[model samples]
Target: MDRFDQLRILTAIVEGGSLSEAARKLNITPSAVSKQLSQLEDRLGVRLFNRTTRKLSLTDEGGVFYERARAILADLAEAEESLASQSGQPRGRLVVDAPVAFGRYCVAPVLGEFLRANPEVHLDLRLNDRLIDPIEEGVDLVIRIGQMKDSALIGRRLSKSRRLVVASPDYLKKKGRPKTPEDLKAHACLLHSLRRPQSEWQFMKEGGGVESLSLAGAFESVDIEVIRVLAIDGLGLAQLPVWLVARDLESGALEEVLSGHLSPDPDIFTLYPSARHLSPKVRSFVDFLVERFGGERAWWATKL
Candidate 1:
Protein backbone atom coordinates (compact mmCIF):
# COMPACT_ATOMS: atom_id res chain seq x y z
CA MET A 1 0.00 0.00 0.00
CA ASP A 2 1.15 3.57 -0.53
CA ARG A 3 2.41 5.05 2.76
CA PHE A 4 0.10 8.06 2.69
CA ASP A 5 -2.84 5.84 1.78
CA GLN A 6 -2.00 3.64 4.75
CA LEU A 7 -2.06 6.61 7.07
CA ARG A 8 -5.34 7.84 5.56
CA ILE A 9 -6.94 4.44 6.04
CA LEU A 10 -5.86 4.42 9.66
CA THR A 11 -7.26 7.91 10.13
CA ALA A 12 -10.58 6.88 8.63
CA ILE A 13 -10.83 3.79 10.85
CA VAL A 14 -10.08 5.84 13.96
CA GLU A 15 -12.58 8.50 13.00
CA GLY A 16 -15.38 6.23 11.77
CA GLY A 17 -15.04 3.66 14.62
CA SER A 18 -16.25 0.86 12.29
CA LEU A 19 -14.70 -1.11 9.47
CA SER A 20 -17.84 -0.73 7.38
CA GLU A 21 -17.93 3.03 7.83
CA ALA A 22 -14.24 3.40 6.95
CA ALA A 23 -14.62 1.20 3.90
CA ARG A 24 -17.56 3.24 2.68
CA LYS A 25 -15.57 6.44 3.11
CA LEU A 26 -12.60 5.02 1.21
CA ASN A 27 -14.92 3.82 -1.58
CA ILE A 28 -13.77 0.21 -1.17
CA THR A 29 -15.03 -3.06 0.31
CA PRO A 30 -14.61 -4.00 3.96
CA SER A 31 -12.29 -6.83 2.94
CA ALA A 32 -10.08 -4.34 1.11
CA VAL A 33 -9.99 -2.04 4.12
CA SER A 34 -9.05 -4.92 6.43
CA LYS A 35 -6.39 -6.30 4.12
CA GLN A 36 -4.81 -2.91 3.62
CA LEU A 37 -4.71 -2.30 7.38
CA SER A 38 -3.13 -5.70 8.09
CA GLN A 39 -0.49 -5.12 5.41
CA LEU A 40 0.20 -1.66 6.76
CA GLU A 41 0.72 -2.97 10.31
CA ASP A 42 3.05 -5.72 9.10
CA ARG A 43 5.14 -3.16 7.20
CA LEU A 44 5.27 -0.86 10.21
CA GLY A 45 6.17 -3.77 12.55
CA VAL A 46 3.58 -2.72 15.16
CA ARG A 47 -0.07 -3.29 15.88
CA LEU A 48 -2.08 -0.11 15.32
CA PHE A 49 -5.51 -0.89 16.72
CA ASN A 50 -7.45 -3.22 18.99
CA ARG A 51 -10.39 -4.52 17.03
CA THR A 52 -13.51 -6.23 18.34
CA THR A 53 -16.99 -7.03 17.11
CA ARG A 54 -18.35 -3.70 18.33
CA LYS A 55 -15.68 -1.03 17.76
CA LEU A 56 -12.02 -0.21 17.11
CA SER A 57 -9.64 1.39 19.59
CA LEU A 58 -6.18 2.77 18.84
CA THR A 59 -3.18 1.33 20.64
CA ASP A 60 -0.48 3.58 22.20
CA GLU A 61 1.66 3.26 19.11
CA GLY A 62 -1.39 3.99 17.01
CA GLY A 63 -1.95 7.26 18.84
CA VAL A 64 1.63 8.28 18.12
CA PHE A 65 1.17 7.24 14.52
CA TYR A 66 -1.97 9.39 14.25
CA GLU A 67 -0.09 12.52 15.31
CA ARG A 68 2.84 11.82 12.97
CA ALA A 69 0.58 10.94 10.08
CA ARG A 70 -1.34 14.19 10.44
CA ALA A 71 1.91 16.17 10.53
CA ILE A 72 3.16 14.45 7.40
CA LEU A 73 -0.13 15.00 5.61
CA ALA A 74 -0.22 18.65 6.64
CA ASP A 75 3.35 19.13 5.42
CA LEU A 76 2.51 17.52 2.11
CA ALA A 77 -0.51 19.77 1.73
CA GLU A 78 1.59 22.85 2.49
CA ALA A 79 4.22 21.80 -0.02
CA GLU A 80 1.60 21.28 -2.71
CA GLU A 81 0.00 24.62 -1.88
CA SER A 82 3.35 26.33 -2.08
CA LEU A 83 4.06 24.83 -5.49
CA ALA A 84 0.58 25.51 -6.84
CA SER A 85 0.18 28.92 -5.18
CA GLN A 86 -0.16 30.84 -8.44
CA SER A 87 -1.44 28.04 -10.69
CA GLY A 88 -4.44 26.68 -8.81
CA GLN A 89 -7.74 28.35 -7.98
CA PRO A 90 -9.66 27.42 -4.83
CA ARG A 91 -11.15 24.45 -6.62
CA GLY A 92 -12.02 21.51 -4.36
CA ARG A 93 -14.69 19.98 -2.14
CA LEU A 94 -15.51 22.05 0.96
CA VAL A 95 -17.37 20.08 3.62
CA VAL A 96 -19.28 21.89 6.39
CA ASP A 97 -21.32 20.55 9.30
CA ALA A 98 -23.99 22.47 11.23
CA PRO A 99 -27.05 22.04 13.42
CA VAL A 100 -30.20 21.08 11.51
CA ALA A 101 -32.51 24.05 12.21
CA PHE A 102 -29.76 26.65 12.22
CA GLY A 103 -28.17 25.21 9.09
CA ARG A 104 -31.45 25.35 7.19
CA TYR A 105 -32.78 28.65 8.51
CA CYS A 106 -29.52 30.59 8.86
CA VAL A 107 -26.44 28.94 7.38
CA ALA A 108 -28.01 27.80 4.11
CA PRO A 109 -28.70 31.33 2.89
CA VAL A 110 -25.15 32.49 3.61
CA LEU A 111 -23.58 29.37 2.12
CA GLY A 112 -25.80 29.65 -0.94
CA GLU A 113 -24.22 33.02 -1.60
CA PHE A 114 -20.77 31.48 -1.13
CA LEU A 115 -21.46 28.71 -3.66
CA ARG A 116 -22.67 31.29 -6.11
CA ALA A 117 -19.54 33.36 -5.62
CA ASN A 118 -17.05 30.50 -5.90
CA PRO A 119 -17.88 28.52 -9.03
CA GLU A 120 -14.79 26.33 -8.72
CA VAL A 121 -15.68 25.16 -5.19
CA HIS A 122 -17.91 22.15 -4.58
CA LEU A 123 -20.06 22.12 -1.42
CA ASP A 124 -21.09 19.37 0.99
CA LEU A 125 -23.19 20.53 3.93
CA ARG A 126 -24.20 18.06 6.65
CA LEU A 127 -26.73 19.17 9.26
CA ASN A 128 -26.89 17.37 12.62
CA ASP A 129 -26.84 18.50 16.24
CA ARG A 130 -24.64 15.68 17.49
CA LEU A 131 -20.99 16.66 17.77
CA ILE A 132 -18.85 14.83 15.23
CA ASP A 133 -15.08 14.95 15.04
CA PRO A 134 -14.25 17.10 12.03
CA ILE A 135 -10.77 15.65 11.40
CA GLU A 136 -12.03 12.10 11.63
CA GLU A 137 -15.07 12.84 9.44
CA GLY A 138 -12.91 14.75 6.91
CA VAL A 139 -15.02 17.88 7.38
CA ASP A 140 -13.33 21.21 6.71
CA LEU A 141 -15.47 23.34 9.04
CA VAL A 142 -18.11 22.78 11.73
CA ILE A 143 -20.51 25.62 12.54
CA ARG A 144 -21.24 24.89 16.19
CA ILE A 145 -23.40 26.98 18.58
CA GLY A 146 -21.65 26.33 21.88
CA GLN A 147 -18.16 26.75 23.18
CA MET A 148 -15.40 24.23 22.48
CA LYS A 149 -14.80 21.60 25.15
CA ASP A 150 -11.91 20.00 23.30
CA SER A 151 -9.45 22.83 22.88
CA ALA A 152 -7.33 20.90 20.38
CA LEU A 153 -8.97 22.50 17.35
CA ILE A 154 -9.18 26.12 16.23
CA GLY A 155 -12.34 28.21 16.80
CA ARG A 156 -13.64 31.42 15.25
CA ARG A 157 -16.49 33.17 17.02
CA LEU A 158 -19.27 33.87 14.52
CA SER A 159 -22.21 35.08 16.63
CA LYS A 160 -23.77 35.14 20.07
CA SER A 161 -27.07 33.45 20.97
CA ARG A 162 -29.23 33.25 24.07
CA ARG A 163 -31.81 31.03 25.68
CA LEU A 164 -35.15 32.74 26.21
CA VAL A 165 -38.06 31.79 28.44
CA VAL A 166 -41.15 32.12 26.30
CA ALA A 167 -44.74 30.92 26.06
CA SER A 168 -47.78 31.73 23.97
CA PRO A 169 -50.07 34.55 25.01
CA ASP A 170 -52.77 31.97 25.75
CA TYR A 171 -50.49 29.90 27.99
CA LEU A 172 -49.30 32.91 29.91
CA LYS A 173 -52.86 34.11 30.23
CA LYS A 174 -53.88 30.78 31.77
CA LYS A 175 -50.68 29.81 33.65
CA GLY A 176 -49.50 33.36 34.33
CA ARG A 177 -46.09 34.77 33.27
CA PRO A 178 -43.16 34.19 35.59
CA LYS A 179 -41.55 37.19 37.22
CA THR A 180 -38.50 35.36 38.66
CA PRO A 181 -36.50 32.14 38.24
CA GLU A 182 -38.36 30.41 41.08
CA ASP A 183 -41.69 31.06 39.39
CA LEU A 184 -40.81 28.76 36.43
CA LYS A 185 -41.22 25.72 38.64
CA ALA A 186 -44.90 26.50 39.25
CA HIS A 187 -45.65 26.55 35.51
CA ALA A 188 -45.60 23.54 33.22
CA CYS A 189 -42.47 23.75 31.02
CA LEU A 190 -42.33 22.22 27.56
CA LEU A 191 -38.83 20.89 28.05
CA HIS A 192 -36.17 19.73 25.62
CA SER A 193 -34.61 16.77 27.39
CA LEU A 194 -32.15 16.34 24.52
CA ARG A 195 -29.54 18.88 25.59
CA ARG A 196 -30.10 19.70 29.25
CA PRO A 197 -33.51 19.01 30.65
CA GLN A 198 -32.74 16.84 33.67
CA SER A 199 -30.00 19.23 34.68
CA GLU A 200 -28.44 22.64 33.93
CA TRP A 201 -30.80 25.61 33.73
CA GLN A 202 -29.31 28.78 35.13
CA PHE A 203 -30.17 32.44 34.85
CA MET A 204 -27.86 35.45 34.89
CA LYS A 205 -29.30 38.49 36.62
CA GLU A 206 -28.75 41.99 35.29
CA GLY A 207 -25.95 42.71 37.75
CA GLY A 208 -24.23 39.37 36.83
CA GLY A 209 -25.33 37.16 39.70
CA VAL A 210 -26.86 33.81 38.58
CA GLU A 211 -29.86 31.84 39.82
CA SER A 212 -30.70 28.26 38.88
CA LEU A 213 -34.05 26.49 38.49
CA SER A 214 -35.46 23.22 37.14
CA LEU A 215 -38.91 22.53 35.79
CA ALA A 216 -40.66 19.31 34.77
CA GLY A 217 -43.24 19.53 32.03
CA ALA A 218 -46.10 17.58 30.48
CA PHE A 219 -44.44 17.80 27.05
CA GLU A 220 -40.76 17.06 26.49
CA SER A 221 -39.20 16.56 23.09
CA VAL A 222 -35.88 15.98 21.43
CA ASP A 223 -37.01 17.97 18.43
CA ILE A 224 -36.65 21.75 18.63
CA GLU A 225 -39.31 22.19 15.96
CA VAL A 226 -41.71 20.08 17.97
CA ILE A 227 -41.07 22.09 21.11
CA ARG A 228 -41.55 25.31 19.14
CA VAL A 229 -44.90 24.28 17.71
CA LEU A 230 -46.02 22.95 21.08
CA ALA A 231 -45.15 26.20 22.81
CA ILE A 232 -46.96 28.18 20.10
CA ASP A 233 -50.05 26.05 20.65
CA GLY A 234 -49.88 26.94 24.37
CA LEU A 235 -48.47 23.68 25.68
CA GLY A 236 -46.80 25.05 28.81
CA LEU A 237 -43.55 27.06 28.71
CA ALA A 238 -40.24 26.52 26.92
CA GLN A 239 -36.71 27.69 27.47
CA LEU A 240 -35.71 27.97 23.82
CA PRO A 241 -32.65 29.14 22.01
CA VAL A 242 -33.34 32.61 20.67
CA TRP A 243 -32.34 31.63 17.14
CA LEU A 244 -35.15 29.08 17.05
CA VAL A 245 -37.84 31.55 18.14
CA ALA A 246 -36.72 34.93 16.85
CA ARG A 247 -39.44 35.60 14.32
CA ASP A 248 -42.17 34.41 16.65
CA LEU A 249 -41.00 36.81 19.35
CA GLU A 250 -40.84 39.60 16.76
CA SER A 251 -44.44 39.03 15.63
CA GLY A 252 -45.64 38.71 19.27
CA ALA A 253 -46.77 35.12 18.80
CA LEU A 254 -44.63 34.36 21.82
CA GLU A 255 -43.90 36.70 24.72
CA GLU A 256 -40.59 36.73 26.61
CA VAL A 257 -40.44 36.71 30.42
CA LEU A 258 -37.86 36.90 33.24
CA SER A 259 -35.65 39.44 31.46
CA GLY A 260 -33.64 40.10 34.62
CA HIS A 261 -32.89 36.40 35.08
CA LEU A 262 -31.72 35.61 31.53
CA SER A 263 -30.22 32.29 30.62
CA PRO A 264 -26.47 31.88 30.18
CA ASP A 265 -25.02 33.35 27.00
CA PRO A 266 -24.31 31.00 24.07
CA ASP A 267 -22.18 31.85 21.05
CA ILE A 268 -21.82 30.37 17.59
CA PHE A 269 -18.40 29.41 16.30
CA THR A 270 -16.66 27.73 13.33
CA LEU A 271 -14.24 24.98 14.33
CA TYR A 272 -11.43 23.54 12.19
CA PRO A 273 -8.49 21.24 12.89
CA SER A 274 -5.56 23.61 13.07
CA ALA A 275 -4.65 27.17 12.16
CA ARG A 276 -1.06 26.46 11.16
CA HIS A 277 -0.80 25.94 7.42
CA LEU A 278 -4.60 25.90 7.22
CA SER A 279 -6.13 25.20 3.83
CA PRO A 280 -7.17 28.21 1.82
CA LYS A 281 -10.62 26.66 1.48
CA VAL A 282 -11.06 26.50 5.25
CA ARG A 283 -9.84 30.06 5.71
CA SER A 284 -12.13 31.36 2.99
CA PHE A 285 -15.17 29.58 4.41
CA VAL A 286 -14.62 30.85 7.96
CA ASP A 287 -14.12 34.37 6.65
CA PHE A 288 -17.32 34.11 4.68
CA LEU A 289 -19.32 32.94 7.72
CA VAL A 290 -17.99 35.73 9.94
CA GLU A 291 -18.84 38.26 7.25
CA ARG A 292 -22.41 37.01 7.09
CA PHE A 293 -23.33 35.77 10.59
CA GLY A 294 -20.56 37.32 12.64
CA GLY A 295 -21.62 40.16 14.97
CA GLU A 296 -24.04 40.59 17.84
CA ARG A 297 -27.24 39.15 16.42
CA ALA A 298 -28.74 38.14 19.73
CA TRP A 299 -32.13 36.75 18.78
CA TRP A 300 -33.52 37.49 22.23
CA ALA A 301 -33.45 41.27 21.75
CA THR A 302 -36.98 42.11 20.58
CA LYS A 303 -37.32 44.51 17.66
CA LEU A 304 -38.40 48.07 18.58
Candidate 2:
Protein backbone atom coordinates (compact mmCIF):
# COMPACT_ATOMS: atom_id res chain seq x y z
CA MET A 1 0.00 0.00 0.00
CA ASP A 2 1.07 3.62 -0.50
CA ARG A 3 2.37 5.68 2.45
CA PHE A 4 -0.87 7.72 2.72
CA ASP A 5 -2.96 4.55 2.56
CA GLN A 6 -0.88 3.05 5.37
CA LEU A 7 -1.37 6.15 7.46
CA ARG A 8 -5.13 6.13 6.81
CA ILE A 9 -5.39 2.46 7.74
CA LEU A 10 -3.39 2.95 10.92
CA THR A 11 -5.43 5.95 12.05
CA ALA A 12 -8.70 4.22 11.17
CA ILE A 13 -7.74 1.17 13.23
CA VAL A 14 -6.97 3.32 16.24
CA GLU A 15 -10.14 5.34 15.85
CA GLY A 16 -12.34 2.36 15.02
CA GLY A 17 -10.81 0.34 17.87
CA SER A 18 -10.61 -2.90 15.88
CA LEU A 19 -9.42 -4.25 12.54
CA SER A 20 -12.94 -5.35 11.56
CA GLU A 21 -14.36 -1.97 12.38
CA ALA A 22 -11.57 -0.27 10.47
CA ALA A 23 -12.33 -2.57 7.58
CA ARG A 24 -15.98 -1.63 7.69
CA LYS A 25 -15.15 2.07 7.77
CA LEU A 26 -12.66 1.75 4.93
CA ASN A 27 -14.86 -0.62 2.91
CA ILE A 28 -12.25 -3.35 2.95
CA THR A 29 -12.20 -6.90 4.23
CA PRO A 30 -10.92 -7.57 7.75
CA SER A 31 -8.20 -9.87 6.38
CA ALA A 32 -7.01 -7.09 4.08
CA VAL A 33 -6.89 -4.66 7.00
CA SER A 34 -4.87 -7.15 9.03
CA LYS A 35 -2.47 -7.77 6.13
CA GLN A 36 -1.98 -4.07 5.56
CA LEU A 37 -1.32 -3.48 9.26
CA SER A 38 1.14 -6.38 9.31
CA GLN A 39 2.94 -5.11 6.19
CA LEU A 40 3.04 -1.58 7.58
CA GLU A 41 4.46 -2.81 10.90
CA ASP A 42 7.00 -5.06 9.15
CA ARG A 43 8.13 -2.16 6.98
CA LEU A 44 8.64 -0.03 10.08
CA GLY A 45 10.14 -2.91 12.15
CA VAL A 46 7.77 -2.06 14.99
CA ARG A 47 4.68 -3.61 16.49
CA LEU A 48 1.83 -1.09 16.34
CA PHE A 49 -0.85 -2.68 18.48
CA ASN A 50 -1.14 -5.01 21.42
CA ARG A 51 -3.83 -7.48 20.46
CA THR A 52 -6.11 -9.56 22.65
CA THR A 53 -9.07 -11.76 21.87
CA ARG A 54 -11.54 -9.04 22.84
CA LYS A 55 -9.71 -5.76 22.19
CA LEU A 56 -6.74 -3.92 20.79
CA SER A 57 -4.56 -1.30 22.47
CA LEU A 58 -1.71 0.70 21.02
CA THR A 59 1.76 0.15 22.39
CA ASP A 60 3.68 3.21 23.57
CA GLU A 61 5.61 3.37 20.29
CA GLY A 62 2.35 2.85 18.41
CA GLY A 63 0.75 5.72 20.32
CA VAL A 64 3.60 8.04 19.42
CA PHE A 65 3.43 7.04 15.76
CA TYR A 66 -0.33 7.38 15.72
CA GLU A 67 -0.18 10.97 16.93
CA ARG A 68 2.36 11.97 14.30
CA ALA A 69 0.50 10.05 11.61
CA ARG A 70 -2.70 11.86 12.57
CA ALA A 71 -1.02 15.23 12.29
CA ILE A 72 0.44 14.39 8.87
CA LEU A 73 -2.94 13.19 7.58
CA ALA A 74 -4.66 16.28 8.97
CA ASP A 75 -2.15 18.59 7.34
CA LEU A 76 -2.55 16.82 4.01
CA ALA A 77 -6.35 17.01 4.21
CA GLU A 78 -6.18 20.66 5.16
CA ALA A 79 -3.86 21.39 2.25
CA GLU A 80 -6.27 19.82 -0.22
CA GLU A 81 -9.24 21.57 1.39
CA SER A 82 -7.44 24.90 1.28
CA LEU A 83 -6.77 24.51 -2.43
CA ALA A 84 -10.33 23.41 -3.20
CA SER A 85 -11.81 26.27 -1.20
CA GLN A 86 -10.01 28.75 -3.45
CA SER A 87 -12.66 27.94 -6.05
CA GLY A 88 -15.07 29.76 -3.69
CA GLN A 89 -17.64 27.03 -3.24
CA PRO A 90 -17.73 24.76 -0.23
CA ARG A 91 -17.95 21.23 -1.61
CA GLY A 92 -17.40 18.17 0.52
CA ARG A 93 -19.02 15.76 2.92
CA LEU A 94 -19.51 17.68 6.16
CA VAL A 95 -20.23 15.54 9.18
CA VAL A 96 -21.79 17.10 12.26
CA ASP A 97 -23.02 15.90 15.65
CA ALA A 98 -25.31 17.34 18.27
CA PRO A 99 -27.41 16.34 21.29
CA VAL A 100 -30.49 14.37 20.27
CA ALA A 101 -33.25 16.76 21.29
CA PHE A 102 -31.46 19.89 20.16
CA GLY A 103 -30.38 18.27 16.93
CA ARG A 104 -33.93 17.17 16.21
CA TYR A 105 -35.76 20.33 17.19
CA CYS A 106 -33.15 22.92 16.35
CA VAL A 107 -30.25 21.85 14.15
CA ALA A 108 -32.12 19.53 11.80
CA PRO A 109 -34.67 22.19 10.92
CA VAL A 110 -32.02 24.63 9.70
CA LEU A 111 -30.09 22.09 7.66
CA GLY A 112 -32.39 22.26 4.65
CA GLU A 113 -31.66 25.93 4.14
CA PHE A 114 -27.94 25.38 4.52
CA LEU A 115 -27.91 22.44 2.13
CA ARG A 116 -29.98 24.32 -0.38
CA ALA A 117 -27.62 27.24 -0.22
CA ASN A 118 -24.63 25.01 -0.71
CA PRO A 119 -25.90 22.27 -2.97
CA GLU A 120 -22.48 20.78 -3.62
CA VAL A 121 -21.99 19.94 0.05
CA HIS A 122 -23.16 16.60 1.42
CA LEU A 123 -24.27 16.59 5.04
CA ASP A 124 -24.02 13.71 7.47
CA LEU A 125 -25.60 14.61 10.78
CA ARG A 126 -25.40 12.33 13.78
CA LEU A 127 -27.45 12.93 16.90
CA ASN A 128 -26.49 11.29 20.17
CA ASP A 129 -26.26 12.39 23.76
CA ARG A 130 -22.93 10.69 24.25
CA LEU A 131 -19.85 12.86 24.16
CA ILE A 132 -17.92 12.06 21.00
CA ASP A 133 -14.38 13.03 20.10
CA PRO A 134 -14.72 14.96 16.87
CA ILE A 135 -11.31 13.96 15.54
CA GLU A 136 -11.88 10.30 16.32
CA GLU A 137 -15.41 10.34 14.93
CA GLY A 138 -14.44 12.40 11.85
CA VAL A 139 -17.09 14.94 12.67
CA ASP A 140 -16.61 18.34 11.06
CA LEU A 141 -18.59 20.22 13.67
CA VAL A 142 -20.58 19.57 16.83
CA ILE A 143 -23.35 21.55 18.45
CA ARG A 144 -23.18 21.29 22.21
CA ILE A 145 -25.17 22.63 25.12
CA GLY A 146 -23.91 23.18 28.67
CA GLN A 147 -20.29 23.73 29.64
CA MET A 148 -17.31 23.78 27.34
CA LYS A 149 -15.02 21.17 28.85
CA ASP A 150 -12.87 19.89 25.99
CA SER A 151 -9.85 22.17 25.83
CA ALA A 152 -8.61 20.62 22.62
CA LEU A 153 -11.54 21.79 20.52
CA ILE A 154 -12.34 25.38 19.54
CA GLY A 155 -15.81 26.55 20.57
CA ARG A 156 -17.89 29.40 19.19
CA ARG A 157 -20.68 30.48 21.47
CA LEU A 158 -23.96 30.32 19.60
CA SER A 159 -26.20 31.65 22.32
CA LYS A 160 -26.70 31.74 26.06
CA SER A 161 -29.75 30.18 27.72
CA ARG A 162 -30.94 29.64 31.25
CA ARG A 163 -32.48 26.55 32.77
CA LEU A 164 -35.93 27.32 34.13
CA VAL A 165 -38.28 25.27 36.24
CA VAL A 166 -41.43 24.53 34.29
CA ALA A 167 -44.59 22.52 34.79
CA SER A 168 -47.94 22.20 33.15
CA PRO A 169 -50.57 24.59 34.42
CA ASP A 170 -52.43 21.56 35.74
CA TYR A 171 -49.35 20.36 37.57
CA LEU A 172 -48.72 23.73 39.18
CA LYS A 173 -52.39 23.92 40.14
CA LYS A 174 -52.27 20.50 41.77
CA LYS A 175 -48.77 20.52 43.36
CA GLY A 176 -48.91 24.25 44.11
CA ARG A 177 -46.09 26.46 42.96
CA PRO A 178 -42.80 25.97 44.78
CA LYS A 179 -42.10 29.18 46.67
CA THR A 180 -38.48 28.42 47.47
CA PRO A 181 -35.63 26.27 46.21
CA GLU A 182 -36.11 23.89 49.14
CA ASP A 183 -39.82 23.63 48.39
CA LEU A 184 -38.94 21.78 45.15
CA LYS A 185 -38.22 18.73 47.29
CA ALA A 186 -41.91 18.42 48.16
CA HIS A 187 -43.01 18.53 44.50
CA ALA A 188 -42.68 15.77 41.99
CA CYS A 189 -39.62 16.96 40.08
CA LEU A 190 -38.90 15.37 36.71
CA LEU A 191 -35.17 14.82 36.43
CA HIS A 192 -32.68 14.36 33.60
CA SER A 193 -30.66 11.19 33.99
CA LEU A 194 -27.71 12.69 32.10
CA ARG A 195 -27.55 15.62 34.48
CA ARG A 196 -25.09 14.33 37.12
CA PRO A 197 -26.29 13.48 40.59
CA GLN A 198 -29.75 13.45 39.05
CA SER A 199 -31.41 14.50 42.26
CA GLU A 200 -29.20 17.48 43.02
CA TRP A 201 -30.57 20.72 41.59
CA GLN A 202 -28.88 24.10 41.85
CA PHE A 203 -30.55 27.46 41.99
CA MET A 204 -29.29 31.02 42.34
CA LYS A 205 -30.38 32.64 45.59
CA GLU A 206 -32.06 36.04 45.53
CA GLY A 207 -29.22 37.64 47.46
CA GLY A 208 -26.41 36.15 45.29
CA GLY A 209 -25.68 32.93 47.14
CA VAL A 210 -26.39 29.56 45.47
CA GLU A 211 -28.86 27.05 46.83
CA SER A 212 -28.25 23.41 46.12
CA LEU A 213 -31.07 20.98 46.82
CA SER A 214 -31.58 17.29 46.34
CA LEU A 215 -34.98 16.89 44.72
CA ALA A 216 -36.59 13.71 43.44
CA GLY A 217 -39.76 12.72 41.66
CA ALA A 218 -41.67 10.02 39.76
CA PHE A 219 -40.06 10.47 36.34
CA GLU A 220 -36.47 10.70 35.16
CA SER A 221 -35.11 10.33 31.64
CA VAL A 222 -31.82 10.58 29.83
CA ASP A 223 -33.57 12.43 27.03
CA ILE A 224 -34.48 16.04 27.68
CA GLU A 225 -37.43 15.77 25.29
CA VAL A 226 -38.85 12.94 27.36
CA ILE A 227 -38.45 14.98 30.52
CA ARG A 228 -40.12 17.95 28.82
CA VAL A 229 -42.99 15.75 27.74
CA LEU A 230 -43.36 14.33 31.25
CA ALA A 231 -43.51 17.80 32.72
CA ILE A 232 -46.14 18.81 30.15
CA ASP A 233 -48.17 15.74 31.02
CA GLY A 234 -48.26 16.86 34.64
CA LEU A 235 -46.08 13.99 35.77
CA GLY A 236 -43.75 16.42 37.56
CA LEU A 237 -41.97 19.74 37.49
CA ALA A 238 -38.88 19.87 35.32
CA GLN A 239 -35.84 22.08 35.14
CA LEU A 240 -35.28 22.47 31.42
CA PRO A 241 -33.45 24.78 29.04
CA VAL A 242 -35.52 27.76 28.04
CA TRP A 243 -35.13 26.84 24.37
CA LEU A 244 -36.70 23.46 24.98
CA VAL A 245 -39.85 24.90 26.54
CA ALA A 246 -40.17 28.25 24.76
CA ARG A 247 -43.24 27.22 22.79
CA ASP A 248 -44.92 25.63 25.78
CA LEU A 249 -44.45 28.74 27.88
CA GLU A 250 -45.60 31.01 25.06
CA SER A 251 -48.74 28.95 24.51
CA GLY A 252 -49.50 28.92 28.22
CA ALA A 253 -49.33 25.12 28.31
CA LEU A 254 -46.47 25.37 30.79
CA GLU A 255 -45.71 27.95 33.45
CA GLU A 256 -42.22 28.91 34.54
CA VAL A 257 -41.57 28.92 38.25
CA LEU A 258 -38.57 30.20 40.23
CA SER A 259 -37.20 32.08 37.25
CA GLY A 260 -35.39 34.37 39.65
CA HIS A 261 -33.70 31.38 41.26
CA LEU A 262 -32.78 29.19 38.26
CA SER A 263 -29.14 29.17 37.32
CA PRO A 264 -28.07 29.91 33.76
CA ASP A 265 -27.57 26.99 31.45
CA PRO A 266 -24.14 26.73 29.90
CA ASP A 267 -23.84 28.69 26.69
CA ILE A 268 -24.77 26.88 23.50
CA PHE A 269 -21.68 26.25 21.38
CA THR A 270 -20.66 25.02 17.94
CA LEU A 271 -17.34 23.28 18.41
CA TYR A 272 -14.78 22.21 15.85
CA PRO A 273 -11.40 20.51 16.01
CA SER A 274 -9.46 23.65 15.10
CA ALA A 275 -9.80 27.32 14.38
CA ARG A 276 -6.87 27.82 12.01
CA HIS A 277 -7.15 27.12 8.28
CA LEU A 278 -10.64 25.65 8.69
CA SER A 279 -12.04 24.11 5.51
CA PRO A 280 -14.66 26.20 3.78
CA LYS A 281 -17.30 23.53 4.34
CA VAL A 282 -16.74 23.59 8.11
CA ARG A 283 -16.29 27.37 8.27
CA SER A 284 -19.48 28.04 6.31
CA PHE A 285 -21.50 25.70 8.52
CA VAL A 286 -20.13 27.28 11.68
CA ASP A 287 -20.88 30.74 10.32
CA PHE A 288 -24.39 29.62 9.40
CA LEU A 289 -25.01 28.41 12.93
CA VAL A 290 -23.78 31.68 14.39
CA GLU A 291 -26.04 33.66 12.06
CA ARG A 292 -28.98 31.53 13.06
CA PHE A 293 -28.47 31.30 16.82
CA GLY A 294 -26.01 34.00 17.90
CA GLY A 295 -26.83 37.15 19.85
CA GLU A 296 -29.94 39.28 19.13
CA ARG A 297 -31.20 36.77 16.57
CA ALA A 298 -31.49 33.86 19.01
CA TRP A 299 -35.23 33.59 19.54
CA TRP A 300 -34.75 31.05 22.27
CA ALA A 301 -32.46 33.35 24.20
CA THR A 302 -35.03 36.14 23.81
CA LYS A 303 -37.77 34.01 25.44
CA LEU A 304 -36.21 34.26 28.86
Please name the candidate that would achieve the greatest lDDT relative to the true structure: 2
Error (Å) of candidate 2 at residue 287 is 0.8
Best by TM-score: 2
lDDT of each residue in 21-97, candidate 1, tens digit only:
99999898999889989999999999999887876899999999988987897678667655544554554667899
**Candidate 1 accuracy as TM-score:** 0.69
lDDT over C-alpha atoms for residue 261 of model 2: 76
Error of 1 at 152 (Å): 2.0
Runs with alpha carbons beyond 4 Å of true place in candidate 1: 1-88, 197-199, 297-304
- Give lDDT: candidate 2, residue 182: 81
List per-candidate RMSD values in Å: 6.8, 5.9
How big is the positional error of residue 226 in model 2, measured in Å on the Cα after superposition? 0.9
Clashing pairs in 2: none
TM-score of candidate 2 on Cα atoms, chains taken together: 0.72
Count of backbone collisions within predicted model 2: 0
lDDT of 2: 0.86
